[model samples]
Target chain A: MFHNDGFHALDRQECLRLLAKVPVGRVVYTRQALPAVLPVNFSLDTDSSVLLRTPASSDLVRAIDGAVVAFEADDFDAVARSGWSVVVTGRATVVTDPAEHERLSRTGPRSWVVTGEGVFVRIESEMVTGREITVPHSTD
Target chain B: MFHNDGFHALDRQECLRLLAKVPVGRVVYTRQALPAVLPVNFSLDTDSSVLLRTPASSDLVRAIDGAVVAFEADDFDAVARSGWSVVVTGRATVVTDPAEHERLSRTGPRSWVVTGEGVFVRIESEMVTGREITVPHSTD
Candidate 1:
């Protein structure tokens, strides 16, 4: 359904489907009690959890472990003035179990940059919301 | 200079230049003490402040007014595995002065959607940082 402002609200299933199509997204987390955002490549686990693989020593892992964060991804066409955006909010936890780590290492997202031993951070898909902007039909 | 992870750090001037090139970005804020992010089209003011125009009664106007917020914009080439991202953190204030509002109405960003009377939110460019990911040269 379209909101009063003309944005179409996307259902949870649709949101998840759209999210899996994109390889990169922005992670929102708190840094020193203020908001910080970083663009990272991510993947969705079978259960729909957002998965990120980064250097175990990266600052992002330190800042977001066990913290409530938001992940957003979108595709926009400036020339066509149409796009869709999805936001997922949930608690992020670092995967520590060696077996799970090994499984994720084999199945999770690959790091865009090669670094030291990699770690996996998972954000539960607790809340998912999305909106789409459609160009109104030309009256002419 | 490249960081240990091979990401090139962008200076302030370069960040602003890049920010202006993108017409849309994500705004990060705190909602119910958790991070929230939304895609917004923005422009840089003469003083380099991030200016967003939204419906005066929009939820974003209420959530970000007089609050610390983060704005981020980036462009990436998935095939080439390269891109740059810039983040700006600062205080967001609603433009209330009638003269300033009028001036911004003429000079600020145009909303992607048409709505009721619009309000202007300016995010000071207090802390700006960015990084660039360059595809590694083929050793072959």
Candidate 2:
């Protein structure tokens, strides 16, 4: 009953669940007053926060630190014509604590862009929302 | 030779060609002065513009018209650990011309979210860039 214009809105719990399953997603941040989406691998923390690892000297580290950002993940089938999308809006803060870093290293997302100094950025979820559309079943 | 931190930057022509291959992507627009990425089905136009068909009554239709937004499309293999992402920054304008819509229909990306007023929103590409990371060749 949550359908709207063929896409149904998902609740907070479902959104988090779906997000936790996806390994790769895009992060949107403000770049010179315009938005830019950067694809990255992320891990969902126990507290519902998002952990992202990137190069210490990369643009992702430079653009967002203690700044508001958004992350999105989705899965869909082209032929079957179905999918779900979960988006999280939060603030990203660079983790500087060594103990926290070590703890996060054991549980946080591993960096995909290798061969650079790895840095961890944690996004504290402020709002989460999702939508899904599924293909209709055909009766035999 | 273009590799930096294990990722290679794609040129402009390569970025556009790659963008045309994807049918589904996310569009980032300003919602309440914050960035929001909405998954969308889009077509790459002849002039390098991005075309998206959403419900006329939808938020994408409402928030993007004449507004600067971002569009991202990518493909990655989680197991093989390789992928590329191309992001385009542009301005979205609702297509009011029926003739243009008809022409676009012949070659443009088809609408996915059904059951609403189909409004054509074309994002004029102002800048485009992409990066790809390839899996390392294994030598046994």
Candidate 3:
């Protein structure tokens, strides 16, 4: 669907596809009654949940576990004057089962930064939305 | 300040400086009690406020006006394994006064998409924080 403002709305399937193409994104969560954003490398789980690996004691885990959060990823071309952005918003929780954690350790996204004793956090894809801005071609 | 996970914290002055270097960012706000994020092109006002120009009737204007929002901008090099991200959290208000609107129309950011009757929304920099990840040089 195209909006009057030149943004073309993307479907859920297309949003997930675009998400898989990027390795890093920003996670938005509430901090001190205000919004906070952090860039992190993430991957999609088998169930299409947004998966993140961070230090077990990191502030992110403390703030986002059992809380609603938003994950956003996008790519843009400055010269082309176009880009697409995808956002997933849902409740985030820490994966506590040892077996699942071990499984994710082997298959999940590799942490961009070095860390010790990492834990897996999953943001359920309850809502996924995206938009694309395309440059209009001129017919001269 | 450097965190154990390799993130070097940046001060407010540096954060604003980095924000001025980018033309685009993601704005995070609450929509129906869930977080929503959208990519936007913005500029820094003289008082270091985040300035966004969008259609007057856009959803973003409705969702963020007089609300706390988060604006984040970053630049990263996957191959170099280095980047910096700056986030500004503040209250956003639409410029309603005709005089201020006219002044901003001449000095504010240009909307990335074509729009009719643009409105300027200013997000005050109440809290500015950032982090940088630098590739550590090996000492063999």
Per-candidate interface DockQ score = 0.52, 0.49, 0.47
Q: lDDT by residue for model 1 over B1-140, one digit each (tens)?
A: 22766588999999999999999999999877778898988999999999998777778878899998999999988767789999999999999999999998889987777565588999999999999996572221
Candidate 1, A1-140: lDDT as tens digits: 22655578999999999999999999999987789888998999999999998777788888999998999999988766689999999999999999999898889988788565678999999999999996572221
Could you say which candidate leads in DockQ? 1
Off by over 4 Å in 2: A1-3, A135-140, B1-3, B135-140
Clash pairs for candidate 2 = none
lDDT at position A124, candidate 2: 85
Backbone clashes, each candidate? 0, 0, 0
TM-score of candidate 2 on Cα atoms, chains taken together: 0.91
Model 2, B1-140: lDDT tens digits are 22556688898999999988877888988888887888887888889899887667777778889999999999988767789999888898998898997786566666765543477888888998898986472221
Q: What TM-score would each prediction reach against the true structure?
A: 0.94, 0.91, 0.93
Instruction: List the candidate numbers ranked by DockQ, top first.
Output: 1, 2, 3
Over 4 Å off in model 3, which ranges?
A135-140, B135-140
Instruction: Give model 2's docking category.
Output: acceptable
* TM-score of chain B, candidates 1 onward in order: 0.93, 0.87, 0.93
Question: Comparing candidate 1 with candidate 3, which one achieves the higher DockQ?
Answer: 1
Q: What interface RMSD, in Å and to 1 decimal, does model 3 have?
A: 4.0
Query: Which residue pairs in candidate 1 collide?
Result: none
Distance (Å) between predicted and true CA of B140, model 1?
16
